[model samples]
Target: MMMQISIDPASNKHSLLNVMHRFIAAANNMDETIMVPSLLRDVPLEEQANNNNNNDDDDDVAETQVASNKQRDMYEHYLLLKSIKNDMEWGLLKREMSSGASFLEIAVKQEEEEQQQPSVKRDLAVEDNADLEHQFHYHLRGLFGVLSKLTLQADHLTNRYKREIGGGNFMR
Candidate 1:
């Protein structure tokens, strides 16, 4: 006999666990949908146009030049999404800080900044546990929103890839 688990749709929809699950599902779907990852190479994401728009022509030109130099292919995006999902499931691996500053130097700088902001220190000290809890929840909500957006992006990429190869009946 096999065991099955059921989730309460109403309550689970807004939960963090659900958001993470949705992102994982979307990533998996995208991975399966894109048969030839090479086909996605050099294909710009639909959202890239929105990001590239700038009022100033000079700034736009400079940004376009920089963006063109550093633009990643859709295959890279797929890999990145998979890597992020893996990291989220199994906590991020610890790596040495890339910045040239030593840990002690960073600590000293933080101490100096704290010393220069007595009022900020006092405000932090005054914050109660409930306030801290509220802050945590606030950030958690933001994380959920980000995860949802990433999930949508992964789905969009999958559809785009299908359309490119004339594989699936993709709408929009």
Candidate 2:
């Protein structure tokens, strides 16, 4: 004998919480699948190269070099995904700011930029509570899309890792 659990599809299907849980599960699966993180160290990400190639704004040699150096290997991506999952579960903690700029300075610069913008644009920023709810939903939908992509990426990485170790038959 077996017991079955019922769930309401309408309530859970497109919910932000559900999307987050999916990402967390994928991240956990990735963490378990990759036993040796160092194996991924020098492996270049295809998506990163594609993204860099798509951007046409890299006109300067220094900027191009910087962008190339900014590219992370699979190991870094694994750590990043795990870190993001941890942050999503436990909430983000503030870290020490870099020496480049202080928070107050950044805030002042933003205020100046906002002031320089047109009055009409600033007026449009003001909204009622209903608009706030709409904005929240809109951002939530975008977040869901991003998280879903990340979940798929995690699964892809796991499969890639397994293949790298000559266990190509194993996949999730």
Candidate 3:
């Protein structure tokens, strides 16, 4: 869609400058679709032609708000795909190695991490309706958290023992 935005360059320099800034920004971000409408909305044809605008500050504020919204949209889109891929992989891991310690351990760890972590958005899948694949994501986070802590504690103790003695080795 070709968005032909006509902003009056004859208006006060501030409005004109900001429009040029937004146009350049949209082009740099590959967000050309947002350029025409956003610029036009801030500088109406009547106000531009009258050469008497009262909302110069409002224009800057609106620009910042719009920029924030665009950034948030990009972030959400990225996370949605990432979460889906992670859950799918966890599901496959669970299905292929049900009886193995490694698989069970991983599943449990993933569940814990999900519980403890605070993210920008919660998993889109609801618990009640989630399939085996999504469910495994939770379980896997938990298993990983518990194992990581245990591993760290074990290493700490081993280090302490080694420091106390000349030659100390621990494995069990």
Candidate 4:
């Protein structure tokens, strides 16, 4: 797989892998909860909290994040396996939505729950087990759109070449 090529020790993934050392070694300390793709895009719940915390009603966003037990991973993307398998973090978020919890609300509640405790360890290691923020997923959605557009462009180029240059008459 492309991931293996990029993650190989001889490969550039250690430099390129950013999130995990055995993966991307970005700055020697990438957040473990964040997906590599999400980090590459610089979208995370912590960052998003700052943007959405302008109103007094949303003030809990930042305080909650800051107050939460740091023992837990701030983001949930890297903890996901299917995302790595499919290489689609956005899909992981969508799938999380199916669990009946809105992404934003989960992000908010998680802080409230963690802050109320001192030793807040979790067991999100199960497949698709944790409730993660939506922003990470949305970032991946944007990535998916870009990838789709690129694929479309590649198809267009192939069709144009066959019809215009090769005159293959393969039109349907």
Candidate 5:
């Protein structure tokens, strides 16, 4: 006897959401070595410094900064997709499918900039640590870009949802 397991192409939203939840859960359980570097993209020193300027302890700030890189790069891509899906699910960005357009253009520009990073005088002076820092910076930028977009999308969807479903009587 033979058995087959097939995923329906037209599954319902609830199942789709369940799959997303599972993905997030799996990401949460991944080891730090695998996860940390995944979340980084090159962010400017000024921005990074601003992000960490609060009174939080250095370790706390470092953990948050590093956490973004923990997921795999492919996961980062899907996470972007999921974020847009979430925006729609909750009713944020306009329901049209222009989701990846503007963002893709921006990402392409950033990738180009990443490719153009110069190896100069500092490159000669810096050691392996510099290489590591550069890697972390690139990942950090990618992470920040993804997060900022997701947040905006989520907020937009929430406002739309609230407007469409107007506030009602309490049922508690």
Candidate 6:
């Protein structure tokens, strides 16, 4: 069976939205550059500090800090994309899409950054042991979540999109 749809080629709003979706797609896939970095951009250091700072035990605090820091970075990109609206949003989006990284490289970078902290090194050693399983589950959950959201959006579009007669145009 043949299925057809129409889109107005000159809609700037749609173009802008497409750009937004591109970044979102990258983030949804957990790409380190456009997605992960943006995820980290807005996490106030104060909150990060406080999350682990509450622990009285220094070792516990160190472990908590390392764990939470990694968590914060994981979805940093999506959070960033969610924060973007009008105004300078395009600039941010442009920069992110132009430069992003894979999960492996991001991990390497994080390792390099934490190399100086011996306590974090211990924590990282612990983390590395289960890295594959953690990544697998995280990506699995992310996959479902992104698909659910995208499916909902597609459903909404299907509901709104009306077919036009005698032409390849669709009315929304």
Predicted structure with the largest lDDT when compared to the true one? 2
Cα distance off (Å), candidate 3, residue 125: 18
* All candidates in order of lDDT, best leading: 2, 1, 6, 5, 3, 4
Relative to the true structure, how large is the alpha-carbon lDDT of every model? 0.67, 0.68, 0.39, 0.38, 0.42, 0.42
**Residues 19-131 of candidate 1: C-alpha lDDT, one tens digit per residue:** 88899998889888877776666655433465435224543433333344356766777777777777777654322133466767777887999999989788777875538
- Residue 142 shift from truth in candidate 4, angstroms: 0.5
Model 2, stretches more than 4 Å misplaced?
Answer: 1-11, 47-70, 94-130, 167-172
lDDT per residue for candidate 6 within 1-172, as digits (tens), equals 9878778544443354454454454333433323224323433322234434443454343243335334443234234334442213455545544468655666687788887697978887788886879887787667555444433332222221211111222212
Off by over 4 Å in 5: 1-130, 167-172
User: What does the lDDT read for residue 106 in candidate 3?
Assistant: 80
- Which candidate has the highest TM-score of all? 2
* Global local distance difference test of model 4: 0.38
List the candidates' TM-scores in order: 0.57, 0.58, 0.22, 0.22, 0.25, 0.28
Question: Model 3, 167: alpha-carbon shift in Å?
Answer: 11
Runs of candidate 6 with Cα error greater than 4 angstroms are 1-112, 161-172
Q: How does candidate 5 fare on TM-score?
A: 0.25
- Please provide the root mean square deviation of candidate 4 (C-alpha atoms, Å): 22.4
Stretches off by above 4 angstroms in model 3 are 1-130, 167-172
Candidate 1 vs 6: which has more TM-score: 1
Candidate 6's displacement at residue 119, Å, is: 4.0
Report the Cα lDDT for candidate 2. Answer: 0.68
